[model samples]
Target: MSDLRRAAEEWLAQDPDPATRAELRDILDDDQALADRFGARLEFGTAGLRGELGAGPNRMNRVTVMRAAAGLAACLPSGGRVIVGFDARHGSRRFANDTAAVLAGAGLRPEVFADPVPTPVLAHFTRAFDDVVAGVMVTASHNPPRDNGYKVYWADGAQIVPPTDAEISAAIDRVGRVDALLLGAGWLVHDGAGLYLDAVSSLNLGTPDPGLSIVYTPLHGVGRDVLLAAFERAGFAAPAVVPEQAEPDPDFPTVAFPNPEEPGALDLALALAADRGADLVIANDPDADRCAVAVPGPEGWRVLTGDEVGGLLAEHVLRETSGDDRLVVTTIVSSSLLRSIAAAHGVRFAESLTGFKWIMKAGGPPDVAGERGGSSPHRKPDRLVFGYEEALGYSVGDDRGVPVADKDGIGAALAVAALAAEARQGGRTLLDLLDDQARRYGLHATAQLSIRVDDLSLITAAMNRLRAAPPARLGGCAVESFDDLSHGEDGLPPTDGLRFRLAGGSRVVVRPSGTEPKLKCYLEVVLPVDGDIAADRARAAADLDALRADVAATLS
Candidate 1:
């Protein structure tokens, strides 16, 4: 018999978990499936373990999870306390318990969230537990139904970085087999939602406007209760929830991918908005850390891109809390309009490598101690109050004022409502305000071309091809310079990506998605708007479309 078949038979013989044994029985029937599942253990990269569920070391099954938990326990500070949280994804809760049990068996006290919740809540709890040395959140934020992930965070509440990742990986390697775990009940449960909301409330975007009407969708995940509670607590009129997606369903019945960025995912919310003439539509992915917003545009209700929403939010927040010490932070791949916007207000603008964990490196203050999250930016950036990324993650607060280092879709929605209300009070619409902002900021428009590939190697090949020989000219403009992120002085570890600057201030950035098998191309076209929103909007729209085509042609 083959080794995979032998392993499967062994698992079936010894596996006490009936469900796991049943799964193993089915996996053994298909030879190829059995091989795929049992061929090798799930490898831990800098990010941690993420794979589909099945009955092998290669899958996210009990055996694999326990092994990973054993490695984590081995790596923890000697007898250090650890906290764990899980989302509403399938098997996440079970994985959480398995992790705690494994850690407890290693003589570490593990505090777990009592129920499935959003990732941000986990992030908050990671910090709230002062005695804790590390944290784990089991979620594949915004991925499709069949997908799930495991992410590790340090005391700073950010995802694990560098030597820590390497150390944990080594320990994981030492755990050579599934049976290498000690299981026990040294696990304590806590209220993650309450703690997470308390942190979010502290970053109150002043107040929500009663005049703004909103249709919010949780996308059939765990943000329903926390988001609603946040809006209510923040003094915003309770948003009308999209009934079909108001509750947590691991199947995510309403949306195919459970990502609001996709067109079809927002259809229900958009339709509801149209029916109610609501001012805006807001959505959160399954775990709720990523947010998507739709606004009343001249072209009917439209969902804004992450860059647009992020730029507008920064602009509004800076305006509301204008101060000499204002600072705005975002990933290098995000819209450059934010730089100009920050420049306009004389606020400090800084760029971090992609990922909120990197952004969280800009940490908080000394006296305002709370949680052990990713390091803060500046001992608390003076008015260090806002950050975002193109992937729809955002943060708003002084490093020390509660833990919003992770994105909060519910919070973003409430802030947008307040901004919309203020605009309405001035007899203007969001589009009109956007036009004004763009005109002042030089009409910075951006678009992204995402290519999905089944094979991971193809993405690597594409990145290598672009890096070895980038475009000499794009969009009829000569290339002025190149920022090869793979080897640039960006003070970041080599990422496989390239950014090209065109002569006319237009730019294009190419990068592979760190967490998925996809190549991403981001393009920006700047139109100087002397006047006329309609004309400038039309010109910018055409320019963005042309840029999109240009990117597609170049990448293809």
Candidate 2:
């Protein structure tokens, strides 16, 4: 009779999976469990649906996936074509097939991938096909083994933004009993693997040195075959792959978390790199959309931060490219070193709010005739030569060559390999190149202070506290100015975050994580290189440590 019981009963009746039906029935006797499962439906947003795989409206199951599919079908044009792709995750293939079936039933043409592929492959296909109205990628993308998700991309091969997401959400609200929706069969299946591989191979700027030894690991995801194929096509030697983490395993048993950015995720790869005496190490998250790189240093091997990788790649692309209309982009939280790099290279640069959605838009097509700019002062530039974020996401190719609208780990991996090989030819390492840049552009050091919390409200409380009473000084330097991003300022769109510029040119940006329960504070300090490179690096690193402490104190 209660609302919870009523919703559970309704969901159970339509759920085709016997396991979910049994799950709901067993939890019916426990009020807390029932309420948690049916308390509210998972809200589909621009990123699409992502949650733990289980029963009930709040979880990711056949019924929830079916409803989402039906909603997406209703939102699209009557006869538009849709592309569906999935990774090797629990229930991913089932979810992808369900989406295709639902779209087919809605009188829309649905083309599903023949096998599990990377997320970037889906993004590429969505853009390559002129008839594709939208794209649905069923993957959690770097999340743990127990979770699965659905990501939606528009005709531009980018994730759905603004009004589009809202419109699709409204259509989803109208979706009723899953049983009422016809589950069609015999949808068209397409093999986009070759197309994706070719696109990745095209990103190779020139012939890489054949003797460049490398180590790679997919972290038990689906990136191995695609990356290897790309490398081979680019004329690079076959990389020695980490045997334990080479294949796609839904359980992701080796790593505590599937994301490469997490600590210990690349242990196996690093060990293999040392044993093989490789020149470089590359890793991709479970879905293979994000790439991480590591290099051997004076103190063994160390992973480069996303900021470091962005700077190195930007410089490499700019040096190889020649033109007046060249453009590079990064987020506000990313290191300011990119701005310096762009200016030095005589290329235009812009900063966007966090996320690839804004970064890709800023890196517009070759023609910006009728497109209007966004709140960021650097919106919709003349030509987007390169775009990257601090979270290991990069789009190397422009509109003409590869046409990958989203981050491509495969492309980034190829680029990194080529850069390492070229550096080797110069009798230098990747770290040497980065150090040289620091000397020219002043030592730009960065660190992060991330505090994970069990209770979500703690994050909101921290943000409120910082805004109410801003910090006056950080790292013993006077704060010059503070900008609250909520109301929008400095040409940036309204976002919930704070930015501070210290008198000594140091910077800090604090905000709550959009996808996780945590408060992240990005800290940076710029120290002139002077004459001594080693001493300058030491001093800069120490200053960054001090700045990190000060910001952490403010958050606490």
Candidate 3:
């Protein structure tokens, strides 16, 4: 027998799932298929293990999840409790249960959620307790239906970062035969609804009056029940849910992609909003860790970009909260308008790498992040009032300044509702709030040029070309300075990206998407709004379009 066939047979021999075993048997006679299955194992990254569901280590399956769970167990001290949760996706429940069993067998207490829950609920439970050393969530977030993922969180209620990921990977490599590992069964099926719902409901900065007509959809994932409960508790009338997507459906039959940001994904919600004459539309992606908001204007209904929402939430949070230590944060690729807003409010502002792991870590427990000494280079107070990424991930910290340390779609929805209702009281719309921000902080318009690729080498070659022969000028403006982000300058962690600053605060950042196979170019142009606001808006849009074209040409 060939070596690849032998390897496949061995994997089949110990495969626990009957379906996967049959899968291996069918592919055994196909050399190319066998090679594909056994050629690689999923590598642990900052986001943890994620891939297509299949029968090999290269895929997400029982054996792979067990190995990952064992690796995580090995990194922690015995007897410490670990939390496990799953979403409504293929193999997610099984993977979560397997994680609990492995953690239990490793002599750690395991607390598994009784039902499939949103990703943020698991993060909340992990951070709310002192006994939990770590947490594992089985979800792919907004990935395709055929994919599932494992996300690891530390006791801080944030996703694992840095050396911890490296350490977990080493422990996974040290694992032996999957069939030889002992299994345990003392883990509890937990219910975190009450704890999480109450906390998130309280995030309502103010009671939303019944005048705010709202339409909501969970997009056939797990956000419906929890979001409805939170909204009702927050004193707002129950939102009209998109009936077709009100229940948890693992197949996600309605949308091509489960992410709310995808075009046409929110068609149903928008339709429902129009039918009901609703003032606002809210959507939570498959796992409910991210939120998207849509509003009606003179041009009709449109979904607000994440940066716009971030700006509105930051201004509202800082204005409503009474604290001298208020701090707000956003990713480097996000709009710098938040910095200007923070300055006007006399609050602290910091920038972190893309993910919430770095955001929460930098925002801090106060004692750990101070004076740019140990792990951080800035003075981050424990008062991280708000943090967001341009990709619809937001954390609106409560009055205590203690957010879940991760994105909370449910909480963000409530906060947005409160803010929208307040605006309506003054006969204004969400678009007006955005316009006010533009006038206050100069019109900061942004766009994106994203390129998808089937071959991974395309991305590598594109990055190399950009670095080797940089563009001198783009969009009729000279390139003032170029930054290679991998060198870890400006107190930021080294990442594979490039930034080009243009003449009038217009800039472009090119980087690979962390979860998808795409090269995303973030473009922002800041234009002064000293004259007619309408003319200024039109000029800003034109400038942004030009910048986007230049960026795309340079990258291509």
- State residue 385's C-alpha deviation in candidate 2, in Å: 1.9
Query: Per-residue lDDT for 1-556 in model 3, tens only?
Result: 9998888888887778999999999988998887787888889989999999998888999999999999999999999999899999999999999998888899999999989999989999998889999999999999999999999999999999999999999999999878888889968889758888868888748758887899999999999999989988989999999999989888999999999999999999999898889999999998999999999988789899999999999898887886656778888899989889987887767788889988786643323233221223443344778999999999997568755889989889989999999999999989999989988898888888899999889999999999999899987789999999999856788999998999999888999988889999999989888868888889888988888888888877
Tell me the tens digit of each residue's lDDT in model 1 across 78-160.
67878888998888998899889888888888889899878887877777767878888898878778767888877877788
Full candidate order by TM-score, most accurate first: 3, 2, 1
| Overall lDDT per candidate, in order of appearance | 0.77, 0.86, 0.88
> Candidate 1: where are CA atoms >4 Å away?
6-16, 322-326, 362-383, 398-402
| lDDT by residue (tens digit), candidate 2, 241-309 | 899998899999999999999999999999999998888999999888899999999999989999999
TM-score, one value per model = 0.92, 0.95, 0.96
Which candidate, 2 or 3, has the higher lDDT? 3
The candidate that achieves the highest lDDT relative to the unseen native structure: 3
| Top-TM-score candidate index | 3
Q: Is candidate 1 or candidate 3 better by lDDT?
A: 3
Worst 10 residues of 3 by lDDT: 366-375
Model 2 segments more than 4 A misplaced: 363-381, 398-402
What is the overall TM-score of model 3 with all chains considered together? 0.96
